[model samples]
Structures are given as structure tokens and as C-alpha cells.
Target: MAHLFKVDRVRLLCSCGVLKPITAIYFCRHCLKLRCGNCVSHEVDTLFCPNCLENMPSTEARLKKNRCANCFDCPSCCHTLSTRATSIQAPSPEDSNKTVARKVYYLACTSCRWTSRDVGLKDQTVATGGWSEQDNEHYKYLQSLLEHYRSVAQQEKLDRERKRFSHRKSAYLSLTDKYSLPSLLGRKSLTPLSPYAPKGDSSQSLDMTASEATAEVEGLPDEIFTEEVVLSSVTDMEQRMASPEWQPEKTSDLYPLHKHILVKRSLRCRHCEHNLSKPEYNPSSIKFKIQLGAFYHVPEVRMIRQVELKSEVETCVQVSLCNPTPHDMTLAFLPFVPEAYTAMQQKVEEPTDGGSLNTSSMVRVVDIPPEKTDLTPSADVALPQGQVILAARDDTAEYDDQDSISSYKDDPLVVAWRRANKVGINLLVTPKANVSRAKVGFVLRYDYTNTVATASESRTVTLNIPVMVDVGTVSE
Candidate 1:
């Protein structure tokens, strides 16, 4: 049981030639292929704070620099800062002789026992916001620089568009040629207009003050090695670097940091351009609108127990196959051929019926090829000859003591045990003479019932998935 949690004894080969667990791979229903993280497209859906769970729009998030306004983090420990209320004595306005107790709120970190008062921050009357933020001295200059760069990029984009349209005639010229009108009439009718052309001269004259290099650099303040230092008052590297704009040297200078906003991302299949996983829009909901994890669509293979092996000797290994889908599955073990698998994957890359989005013209600029994996088996596996039928997943099967009836007959030598939707099988493995560990690879051919099938497509389709198992080390 411990080994099952720690080791990936059984791994499925993804279409990108990388071996991953079934949990990490995704099945694209439209393409009928496996997609790994490296081969999928990620899109940010929403930005929200983890502490307050307040959703923020993309524009607002950008304006706020992707941080929550009300929520704050401790500068010392990088933990969520909680508001602590304390009672303080205040003079009553109605009566000058008496005093009243007023509750004041201050930000405190429970993890590091740091408080806003430690940094000379005044306590606020209200619990929520009102935390003073440090102003950046170079903010105006930075904004000017950003605007200059944006205009430059816009100008370059217009130049490229102009170059692309250089071969084609203008709208005025086209109209004149089509109507056989005089050139004077064409010029008087309308000027040649371009959609990509800049509307004003502001973009053309965009500029910023250039920074000049100085010969002298600012030096650190001198203490003359006379003042004693307290280690507790000094800030560590992590605390000082948390706020890049103002790197505080001492704990007294540390200020409450705005909590960084987190984003919920949706994954799409790179080949088919269909969503593989999409979470709900609400920040509080943990449910996903669409999830196509391989664990739900493909058969999962788990090693029942660790098996002992000897070099160049045959050993038996037991493994369990669980059908995760609601439909019954017919599974068979086939000898894995790396060449055949690669060829089959190439054929699977042909575009299939996808969503309404046209992905044919869409080009990927940042598509990174997955690293090549060694599919050669270190050991030989003698697979079972016949097919094994697995029952549909029943949620209540675990509570029932009586076993369900099976229609299809299973070979006793191949199948060791069967319960619910899981079936245990045994296979013979022979490690190489010089190998220290035994590794066996095979192809699991299963009939998958596609739930998202159209009228023209078949509901049941046969898919062959390459599986590799680590059969443990060979005994000396």
C-alpha cells in the first residue's frame, strides 16, 4: 500500500513519447488521443485571491498589479495577515471627565507573531482596509517609459501590415478600375483608407527621456563599526526581497504586503483545440465544468504487489486493471512494439471532428517538443492470450457482500481474481542478464465507449495504449 502511493509502477506512454501516470494524462474525446501537460494549451480563466476569495477582472487585476486590496500578507513570514482588535481608552466627546473603551484593529501574523505596530503603523478603527501603501518615487517616469514602448510596438506592427499590403492596390484605385472612372474622379471621391493605419500623429511622435549613465554609484551608509547590531531586528533575505520595490533592511521597515492574486486556468487539447479541463467561473466552487482526465476514460493498471526476480529467470507478477468508466470494457494484453506505436500515433495526429473553432489556420509559436523517452523494455513479458471482460463501475458494489454474476468466461491462468469493476491478472517476466531492475512494457488494447459521439461516429471504439511497468529489482 505504501509502495502504491510512492512509486509509479505502471505508467502510460503519452502521444508525445513521454511516459506519465494515468492520473497526469488527459483523454481528448474528439481526437480520441492522450494529451500530456507538455502537449496541451493552458488559458487563464479567472483571477482571485485565495484568502478572501474575491474575484477580480483582468483589467482591474492589471491595475492593482495582480494583488488583493483588502487581504494582506505578513512581511516577515509571508503568511496571511489577520486583523486583530484591541480595546483602547479614549476620551468621550459628551463627557470630559470620563473615558470610553474603543476597539482598534491592527494587522497581525499568527505564524511569526509580527504586528503592524512593530513597524510604527497606526491601528485602524475599521477591520477591513485603510492600510497605508508606500508610494514609488519613479512611478511617473516608469509610466512614461511604458507608454513609449507601447507606441513603438504599435508603430512596428503598422509597418509590418503596410509591408504585407504593399503589393495590393488601394481602395480608391480598385474602385476606379472596377467602374472605369477617371483618375481625377477616383481621387475626389474618397482617399485610400487603411484599417491598420495610425489615426493620429501622437503615435508617431511618442518619446521618453533617455536615462544617462553616471560615473558614481550610491554607497551604503557608514556606521563606523561602532553600533552593535541585533539579529532579531535585522530582516532576512526572504523578508527583504518579498517586496522588490522597497527592500527593507530592518524589521521596523517591514510593511504588510498585498496578497498575490491566483488564477484559475483551463486546459485545451493542442491538436484538436477542444477543452480538456475547464473549471467553473465561481471562485468558491471546486467543481469543473469539463474534465477529461485519463483516469476517467482509460483503464488504470496498478501493481498488486512487488515481485521478486532473478537475472535471466522467469518470475510471475500480479497486477490489477480497473475500469473507471461506467460502460463495460473488454481488455486484452498485446506485445508492445515501439515502432508500431509511433506509427499509430502519427496516424492519430490527423485532424478529427472538433468544436466550432477553426484550428487549421491556428499556429503555435511556443509549442515545445516533448523529450524523447526510451521505450525499450529491460525485461520480457509473456502476456495473457485471451481477453478479459470487466464489469461496469458500480458505486454500491463495495457495500454488497454477494458477488455480481459474470456472463463472459475468464481463463483461470490469466485472471487471478475479480471483484466489481477490477480484475487481477498475472504475467511472466524475465529480466535481462545484466540488468539490476526488471522493467516490462506492453500494449493494453481496450474498447472505449465514447460518450460524446455524433450520429456518424461509432459509440464504441478500440484504443491501444502503451503501458510500462517497473517490476522491481532482480535478486542477486
Candidate 2:
């Protein structure tokens, strides 16, 4: 049956119990496990201005409040604001004094046709630095509070260390009692050792003015209702929200807002602390230096069509599998059970005391990813027992299709047809009548050839990947 609605075309089950699209998943080469957005740790790679495309260090970015000093975003349309310069006649200093016209720079939004003059801002001699800056209202108080909390935490840590070994008063009283050595006039330690004193200023006095609340409230001005409101003259809610610190209401109070900086992120697998994706250091480059996405490594499975799907009734669905590697792969669909995964992991981690058994399995695949999770297949999917051979990806074969042909026999039941490295697979899907919607899931176990370098230089390894298929809503 055809899907009744449009959803994620393909949603793969992550090891962390997340059902995400194949594009959003990552394949860790080191661990040989699939990682999702929630499972991996994200770290900012580079901080750059999206408008200017200029990169800065983390310290500089933080000092500038993660914003670009030269770039500004329009308050009204949220577009990049351009610095415009105009030659205006300078005002005469006095009756006898003569003045000359000078070119001054001001911020203007090209999209909304908003000029800095609308906000009563005077033109600046310099294009970037002369703009006025307002200090955060609660910055000082917040810093003081942060310092107080830090000192308190530090003191508590010191107290914990001091009390960790001995909490008794005698241990801290005197060296004579602690060491059980009496002072001798003839010989001994030259002078009695004094208790170590941390020589540093411990406490700092803070003068903070607490905010006071009043019962009396001020009402809105009468002019608000009496005066005619012009939408162009007044700032909108979104415009005010751009600069949340100020949130000025009047157009005259709308100042040039700093453009927020964008960051490049690097993803790492939390379980093994391995890099799953990392971009080049150059901000202008768009390619990744080391990206191990599932799309490039994992066998791509996409739903072609569902023939018949109903409650308790068996159906046939066609799913296409495309091999992305350079070497041929033997694919087999199997039942996705937790116990099966555990058994495989046990075989991978058999205890070895440097015996023959340990030496034999030393060249085998190592990482055993976590398989126990909340995500499970809702529908029953019968897998094919026969091994499906998929040809290796050939770039030149795409042009010369007739010249390149594989000799592997295709199964009429499981494999509908084969084209280059891609294969069309047909599998049996049965939906349980207990639920309202039909969902089918299974596992793809393949004989993968790991080309990664190792001490043993072994290539063949078995891999299991979870597969999920959405069969759409069941019939009444």
C-alpha cells in the first residue's frame, strides 16, 4: 500500500534510540558504530561572522560578545546593514569661523531604507569604531556575584581536602602530637615547624546595591492613546527583540546591532571519544577534513513502494540498497533482536589470557557498541536467508554501462534487479494488528571488508545495521 502521508522518506534507527534521517547520522570509523546528534559531543571549531566571513579566536569572539564589530544587522528586517557615507556641510563654529564639508559614515539598512539619521545619531568620522557602546546594566553586580560564588566554592574545596585525611582536632593541633616527637634542646629539627599558612588575600568586600520593589505603579501616558501612531515611525516587536538588552520602542532609540557570529562544529562520539566529523580550519572552505558520515559508509536503503499492508496481513515491500564502497559486499537481512547483537558482541570480546584463542581473534573486529536501547521495531519483517552480492562502486562504469557487468547471479525473490553497485531488494513485511499504524523493521547483517589499516592487515569483518521501514497507517 502507498504511504498516505509525507514524512521523513527514510528514518534509520540510531544506537542511542533515536529515529533520524540517514543524512543526520554519522559513522565512526574508529568504533564502527552509528552516532546521532544526541549521542555525539559537539564542539565549536571556528567562530566566524556569517556576513563578513571573518574568523576570530575563541577569546576574541567572547570579548566581542560573539558578534562582529564591523558588521551590523538591520533592526527592522534582520538583514545585513551597510555603512553609507555622505558628504554634508559642516556647521559654522561661530559668525567669524568658517567650516568645510566633510564625508561622514552612518549605518543604513538597504532593505528597509532606514538611516541612522532617523534615530538622531550623529555621523562618525571613522566607519567602524566611533559608534557609541552601552555597558550592560547588571554587569558589575553579576561579576561580583560570580566572584562571591567562586570564592565560596574554592573555600569549600579547600575544606574538603583539609578534612579528607583526618577530621580529629589533635591531628591539626601541634606537630609534637601529630608526629609524636618531643622537642630536644641538644638536637632535633633546627626550629619547630610552624603550621603552614596560605599567604594570600582571602576575602574581598563587595558593595552591591540591591534592587527594591515598590507597591506604587506608574500608569501609561495619556499621549499614547491621544496621539496617532505611525507604524513606520515606531519600532516593531521583532525589531525591538533583536537587541534584547535594550529593546527600545522608539525608532530614534534603535541603534546599530552587532551581527551575531556563526560557528563551525566538530562532532565526536561520546562512547569512544572519536572524531566523527571535522571541517577544515579555513573558514572559507566548505569541505570536511575528516567526515565519516553514514551516507558514505553505510549501505543506503530507501523504500521504493509498499504493495499491500494491513493488520495481521502479510505484504511485500521493495527497498533499494546501494553500495558506497569500492569493494564488493555480501548483504543479508536478518531478524533485529537484542540477544543476537549481544551474542555477536560476546564473540568479539571472548576472554583471552595470551593463549592461542586470544592470538587467533586478535585480528578480528573490536568495538562492541551499545545495543540495549528503547528503540525497537514495531512491525514484523521477514528477512531473506540468501546472501545478496553487491558489486563495488565504479565511477567509470557509469559511462560505459555495457562494458562493465557483474557475473553474480541475482535472486528473483529477494533481489529484483542490479544496476552497477545498486540493488533493488524485496522483503516480506507483516504489521501487527494491535497498533493503529503499521511499522516494519529489521536488521541488515553484511560481510563488510574493513580497509582501515591495522597491525594484522585483515580486511573481512561482519557488521550489523538496524533498519526501519514506515508502512503507513493501517486499514480499518
Candidate 3:
């Protein structure tokens, strides 16, 4: 009996405009055509490892050169190595000896003369269509560990919250006692004056009687004022205590009445064991001042600015080290101007510096040692108008070579051009190894003088550069 497969659709058209079925036909993605394998031109496909064939997805297969993605060849010689599996056999009772069984595949690359012995095979299973046995015990253990950690974290969070609430409540009570008690006591007198007080004459009569009794007690002196008199004197004290003026010192005055008070404390870093602050107090004023000494090195370079009419032009650029450091630091400038360094060096060597330079003549080099004094400038350099100039040197001076004219190099015209065009000059502030922190000030100034009769303008533009320091490494 013969089995037949039906073509669901005709995907290609013949030259005669007749549609053709695509079943058992090869498809050409480039030509957008379908043809039987017999009618189409055939190419040999690459052979791949069987293990790779069972794994890697179709998208990954294309990226991995259509070969087995899981397999790798020897770097010394192109060779596919085999993975071996070994199993120990059980010992028989009569012989009291055991044997072993091993399985391995020999892998070799046809194009390369390389070979290796069978090493080992990874333990993996080729599953038939069925559900795997559930590992309930392992899952339960993981769940228990997760619950334990979560519960511990939640308890710690609750403890922190409780502490915060208690601190807030205590602060609230203290503030209320300080600001509210005086007003509450002052309002107590207003209640008795409220049209109540026994309607005028009765309250007046009670006050007159109290005054006469106080006068009579004052008149009786010495012998009559004995222990019984003292006891009687203390008995009426409770009546006087309720009066606002007779109460103990008001809570409002508990805090110091003075606006400014000196506070003294010592502070230290727990990690580095460094004294961040010392016991220093200013008695005249309540302010505390902290002094930190930071050392910074400013390494800058100056370059001649030249604007060219043509797309390709060479401009002379110079880098110098201004060693602000107490000790000498190494510096160098590397030009990334394509091929401009040769021209810069040639211009430096030439005796005459006669051309009017523009901003385009300046090129910035980045990430070079600040100590390097010698630099060979480029020849013909190509630059786009809006291109960025990133220049760096080992140090912070525009001119380091003693042979060069220092006075002329410090000219505002040169300095302004370099500042406006150079990239790495003020890119970042970097602290030296021994320094704690640095206060860096960067100033870019330019003087423009217009000799034209119609108009004249001169101004300076400044920019602050960020500083970055490299800290020492720490091990995990």
C-alpha cells in the first residue's frame, strides 16, 4: 500500500503563469521561488554534532554557523573531542572482583589536523513524552527556608518600626509639655471669673474675711507661733498650691532662655578609624567650623587655533604640564586628530609662527600621562565643524618644555582657544593618591580684539570642569 501527502496550497508560479504545488519542493528565499529538489541547484550543507542537533534553537543555529552550538573545538588544532561515560560493575560473590563498562564517541574535524582522547560526558536525559517525578521533599525544603528568612526579615522590620514610633511619641510629649502647659494653666483663672463666683457681693465679702484672718495671724508673734502654729501653717498650703502664680517653675522655662548656646562633641569614623572631628569649641559664638585640607594638581595644555576653509587641514596643537602638585607628576598628551600630530610637531620645530589661528586649529587629546613632555603632532587631519575635541595631558600646564617661550604661551588668546576647544582639560578633577579631597577651580578666558573700524568686542567665557578620583580596590 502507498501513502500519499497532499499539498495544501500552490505557492509558486511557472513561467507560463501556471501555479505549482510546493510539497516536496525546495524554496529559494532570495529568488522567492519554489522548485523540486531535482530541478533546483543544490549546495552541500554543513555537518553538525548530534548533541547540538538535539539542543540549540533554530535562531541560535543560524548565529552558531549552522553547526552544533553546544560543541567547541580545540584552540591549538581544530578538533572535536569526544565525551566518555564510565560505569562501575557490581562484584560477583564467587570471584570477589568487579569490572567496569565505558562508552565514548570519537570526534574529529575534517578540515584540521587535531585530535584528543575521550574526556567525559555530561549526565543528561533524553525524555520521552511523559511527566517527570515531582521532587516534593526538595521543594518543601526550599519553601521552608524562604518562609524562615521572610519571617525573620518581617520581625526585624516590625522592631525598627516600633522603635521609631516610641521615639516619635516621646518627642511629641516633650514638645507638648514645653509649649502647651503655660497656656492651659493661664486659662484656669478665666473659669472662676465667668459670671459665676456667687453674683458680685458674696465673692467680695469672702475676700474681705480672708484678708482680716491673714492680718490677725501676722499680729500673733513668737510664743504663740509654736509646732501647732507651724502645722496649721502647712495645712492651708494645699489651697495656695492650686493658684497659677504659686505653682512650681513653669515647664516652658526648663529649656535655656538664651537663643545661642555652645555645644561640644567628638566625632570619628567607625570604618577607617579616622578622627572626622575633634573637641574644638568656639565660646564667643555658637557656630562650629570644620577645616579640610585638599590637594589638587591642575594639568593644562595650550594649542593654537586655526580655522581652515577646506575640509582637510592640519593644525598645530601643544600640551603642557602645570604641576600644582608639591612633587612632580608624569604627564603626556596623545592627539586623536586622525593624522594631525605630524603637522603639530613640524610647526613646533619651525621658527616662524606667523599665521592668524582660529578655533579650528585647536585639537584636544584625552587620557594621556601628564608627565610626557614630547609629542609628535599629526600631518593632514580631517575634522567636521561640530566635532568635539577631547585632549588630555599628564599635567596641568599649557607648556612644559623649557625651550619653548613661556611668556608668549601664557597669552590670553592662546589660553581662550585651548579652553573653548579642548575636551579633557576640564573633563574631570582627579585627586592624587595621598589627598583626601580637592577644591578645583577652572577658568577659561579669551580676549577678542576687533581692529575693524565699524565694531569691536572683547569678552571671556569660563567653564567649570568636573573632577573624578580613582579609589583603591576592595576585595569581596
C-alpha TM-score for every candidate: 0.82, 0.74, 0.18
Best by TM-score: 1
Question: What is the per-residue lDDT of model 2 for residues 308-420, given as tens digits with 9 covering 90 to 100?
Answer: 56777877878888898888899988776755434433332322221222111012222345454334455687787789998888888778737455587876888877888
- Tens digits of lDDT, candidate 3, 223-308: 66563544322313333343323332322111101011112433322222223233334323334342111112132322222112
| Cα lDDT, all candidates | 0.80, 0.69, 0.27
What order do candidates take by lDDT, descending?
Answer: 1, 2, 3
In candidate 1, how many Å is residue 462 off? 0.3
Backbone N/Cα/C clashes per model: 0, 2, 40
Q: TM-score of predicted model 3?
A: 0.18
- Residue 352 of candidate 3: its Cα lDDT? 20
Q: Kindly indicate the candidate among 1 and 3 with the higher TM-score.
A: 1
Error of 2 at 157 (Å): 7.2
Off by over 4 Å in 3: 1-146, 166-420, 423-463, 466-476
Per-candidate RMSD vs. true structure? 8.2, 11.2, 39.4
- Please report, as a residue range, the 10-residue window in candidate 3 with the lowest summed lDDT: 253-262
Residue-by-residue lDDT tens digits, candidate 1, 419-461: 9999999999999888888889999999999999498999999
Q: After superposition, how far is residue 93 of candidate 3 from its true place, in Å?
A: 35
- Which residue pairs of candidate 1 clash? none
